[model samples]
Target: MPTLTKPKEHNRERPVVFMENVSKIYPNGKTAVQNVSLEIEEGEFISFVGPSGCGKSTIFNMISGIIEHSVGKLEILGTTPTLARQQSTDVSFVFQEPTLLPWRSVLDNVMLPLEFRNVTKQEKLEKAHHVLKMVGLSEYTKALPRELSGGMKMRVSIARALVSKPKLLLMDEPFGALDEITRQNLQSELLRIWETEKMTVLFITHNVFEAVYLSTKIAVMTPSPGKVESVVEVPLPFPRNEDFRTSHQFSDIAAKVSQDLKF
Candidate 1:
């Protein structure tokens, strides 16, 4: 996509997600990612912003160990997707869609992931209530998915992701499908959760404003056959509110991100 740089030498402590000179070429010889390197530390919110087909999802998959890299090193939990999953409950992904089962109640849907772990049913129930409350859905615990709005359903999805108390949370455009009002509302809600949970987050978004509002750092990628173009820092203080979004500083940082998305 653009002239790529050499991968950086990383510290041995191994930041939560570490990639060095990584590339992924499919069987048909199509290269989706090229020489990408990044380091994410604990308790940081990192967002990936890029245009369509620019390998944002590819880099995301590599971090989650969903797919392997053809070259260079990726140090997550393990090499294989299955191993990556089996090795940890410390990581969780919240996809764009809520993906709730129709029959389950809101509380039940949130509790489902915990069922797979070694905890007792009582513990699972407790965790479900805790996260549902965290997402401001405590009163809707008994409501069915059909009874909820798009925003509420997504809140359940987020609560489900947090039920495991993960150390790293990877969110893939989790608010992209919502209306403007709902999207902004959820953005505020997410920041609150991040403040309380204090976990590392890796988010993928096409919206520069969203990236600037939620992230500590934004990793901008180039066009197809993606490479890290730049990592823009958001020096804004956290616990941000509506006023922060409307402030000139937020507008300035958002402009920088928009510029990075350019060819």
Candidate 2:
């Protein structure tokens, strides 16, 4: 069994995530990813973009330890991917939809992670309420999933992921299903969360605008044995707001990423 090996003291030299020439191939020899390498610094927000079937999600699965790589090495928080994932040491995944339990109340749902790890009831309630407040859902603690809007449910999912205090967050198109207005709102919320929590985020999105709006770095990929084609750094300053969206720099970077994705 794989065991977690977090450093006794936090090391400034260690990256939050590192994929060194990683690749994944299926049993039938279908190459899902090839020679992909990435290094994510602590507290950085990154977006991975490509057309459908570009192996974007496959990379995320490997980082999350849901799938093992066929070649090369990968590490999350200096611990092996399998150990990091098995222990839930420093990573969380937010899937496309808000997969909240329909039967559970909002507070209970947020506390589910604690339950999974055998946390005390008092600590679970406290942690759940704190994160719900951070996500602006404190008052709805007792409300059932059916009572919340789509956006609110997604917030619940986010709160659940955050309650674990993960250092690395792997998001697979968490906002793909929302309407334009809600999507933008959640995007802003995501940024706010990142700023306050200082977590390293690896987000996967097909929307070029959304990718540019949220990322500190954009990793572009190609399909059919997916490989990273380019990695562009966002030149904009931190604490970016609505005005930055209208700036020329944002447009230029977004355009460049768009042009790269076409291949």
Query: How many clashes does each candidate structure show, in the order listed?
Result: 0, 0
Across 69-162, the per-residue lDDT of candidate 1 in tens digits comes to 8998777643444466677787888998999999999999999987877899889989999999999999999999999999999999999999
lDDT of 2 by residue, 45-88 (tens): 88999989989999999989899999988988998888998877
In model 1, the runs with Cα more than 4 Å from the true position are: 1-12, 77-82
For every model shown, what is its TM-score relative to the native structure?
A: 0.92, 0.93
* Ten residues in sequence with the least summed lDDT for candidate 1: 1-10
Could you tell me the lDDT of residue 153 within candidate 2? Answer: 92
Task: For candidate 1, give the lDDT.
Answer: 0.86
Model 1 TM-score on a 0 to 1 scale: 0.92
Question: lDDT score, residue 196, model 1?
Answer: 88
Using lDDT as the measure, which candidate wins?
2
Compute the lDDT of residue 239 as modeled in candidate 2. 79
- Candidate 2 deviant stretches above 4 angstroms: 1-12
> What is the lDDT for 48 in model 2?
92
